[model samples]
Target: MAVPVVTGRHARLVRVTHALTTLCFLALVITGAEIIISHPRFYWGEVGNVNTPSLFDIPIPASRPWVNTGYGFVMPDQNGWSRSLHFQMAWLLVFTAFIYGTWGLRTGHFQRIASYYNTAQRRTYLLVIFALMPFMIWTGLAMSPAIVGTFPFLVTLLGGHQSARTLHFFTTLALLLFIAGHVVMVIRTGFRSNVRAITVGGDTQA
Candidate 1:
């Protein structure tokens, strides 16, 4: 089979969206890791606090002087900084995603891909772009207290804020795995040609 090459306005838009998504996702993941380390536990339902029985716990070492037990190892609680960056990047992701989705649909980008690519590849792309991404966005919003307060039904639909948080974490893991697999596929198909088509926006004979 001939390797697929992306070009023209569609290629340009895809490249831009891919870059923005990568940067924003990386920021979110780093910030999310820092935030999770502080609590290091997962729960469910509307209410979960320090006293609540955790569904699962990660053994993150305590850092605060009062909580320290001679062991120096600790995960820094950077929620204040991380949370701010996380939300900012999240908004950026949402905006870029909207642009990409709208343009792709209007330009028949999805149709072209579906026609050109094999069934497996087409299905994977559709699943990632349509199904998984929307679910991730929904779960992310559901976890936000402010968002949930404004639209209480969001959290209720997800079972609860904690449930949304749990789903978000797992969804993130799945996305990471998808990214890894995508990279491998690109390498196997035609790395140099793929990179040039995406970066330079021109016809590439793969």
Candidate 2:
């Protein structure tokens, strides 16, 4: 006799994972906005200065009175707190994504993947959105010259840092759109069933 699986916990995890992803996305948007505004002209490879000046041309005199001279906002320096927050949140996102993806795979989420490929799934849009994320993460990490510089081809693949930055922006937009759609769907398609599936790890009446 086979043992019965406790799906409630899984359902809860799913719900939590979605909530977390949504939160992380907002954080990413804010941090990314800071970076872009500060350094509109992005560089690729080791060609240009990555540590450009920030948009806030004002000085925080109150924060650091000990400094002798006035200072203009610098991208690398100004975003220390923002960058740290972004990195910390990104780590959470990456870790949570792994958990969610693993759960999906183990629980025959691949069936959904397959259905999308075969054009049998109801919401094929989700399949496309799902496919984009890993690629975004891969390119995002690859373009980071400071971290994981193992692959030389990455430079060419991304057409240097500038191109990577562009792609990252587009990907971010895509993620935002996906989130918007996801929220709309969750609300439109009877939130109760989704809530139950997510909270209790059990299928509801379809």
* Candidate 2 lDDT, 41-122, residue by residue in tens: 4444434442443222223332222322254433343456767777788898889889977777677654544553335334
lDDT for each candidate structure = 0.79, 0.61
lDDT digits (tens) for residues 1-206 of candidate 1? 22244433236678889889989999999998887866666888877756778777656664343333335676566878998999899999999999988887777778887987789889988888998888988998898789889999988988898989888888888888888988898788678877776776655554
Off by over 4 Å in 2: 1-10, 41-78, 112-130, 191-206
Candidate 1 least-lDDT 10 residues: 1-10
Residue 120 of candidate 2: its Cα lDDT? Answer: 31
Candidate 2 has a TM-score of 0.65
RMSD of 2: 7.0
Best by TM-score: 1
- In model 2, pairs of residues that clash are 8-200, 11-198, 44-161
